[model samples]
Target: METGIYLIVTIVNKGWGDTVLEASMKAGAEGGTILLGRGVGIHEKQTILGISIEPEKEVVLSVTYPDKKDAILQEIVRAAELKKPGAGIAFVVPIAQVAGVVHLFHQGSQSNSEETK
Candidate 1:
């Protein structure tokens, strides 16, 4: 059995990172950082009038407890509908150690993302 922290990576069309992070938070995740990326798959590119068009993608990276990894991953897949091709993909990588999060990386983050209304 894998132990220690696990990194959850989710890649989807632009603007979907937020949705994936939201679902993870509800499943015991602290938060995630989003990065912009481009896909290079055969079906990812399209041409219009001889011009090439590439779809923008969002990559979300987050760390969570190993025990909660499965739940968080499941929620992300369900929320992002990754089961369908071309929607997106998600995976987990085991981590040996993590540092520099002492400043702030847990429970409080959920409130920080909450809207004040």
Candidate 2:
């Protein structure tokens, strides 16, 4: 298990995934993963022609060391304007174990990546 590693999950409007990724990277994260999702938030409800609309969302996951967590999250919030209503949310969770991302701990090691294949 890897201690001191955190996973920052940021969910924002569809087109902002790239912004979150860029922000996290600028704040010292190596990279992040973006996933497509759909849901309607209380402040994001919409309708057109008497039909309901479910907003599309982008789920961004950034894994980083403890030291980089705060900076990355701050940048994400600032870049995404998360403080405003319907701007989306960001949170962090501790990671118990990690694999296939050896580069974060070992600059040149590829063992974990190779073993997976």
> Which of the numbered candidates is closest to the native, going by highest lDDT?
2
Clashing residue pairs for model 2 = none
Provide the lowest-lDDT 10-residue window in model 2.
Answer: 108-117
TM-score of each: 0.78, 0.85
Tell me the tens digit of each residue's lDDT in model 2 across 14-108. Answer: 99999999999999999999999999888999999989999999999998888889999999999999999999999999977677766665542
What TM-score does prediction 2 earn?
Answer: 0.85
* Whole-model lDDT values for every prediction: 0.80, 0.89
Off by over 4 Å in 1: 1-3, 103-117
| lDDT comparing candidate 1 with the true structure | 0.80
How many Å off is the CA of 50 in candidate 1?
Answer: 3.1
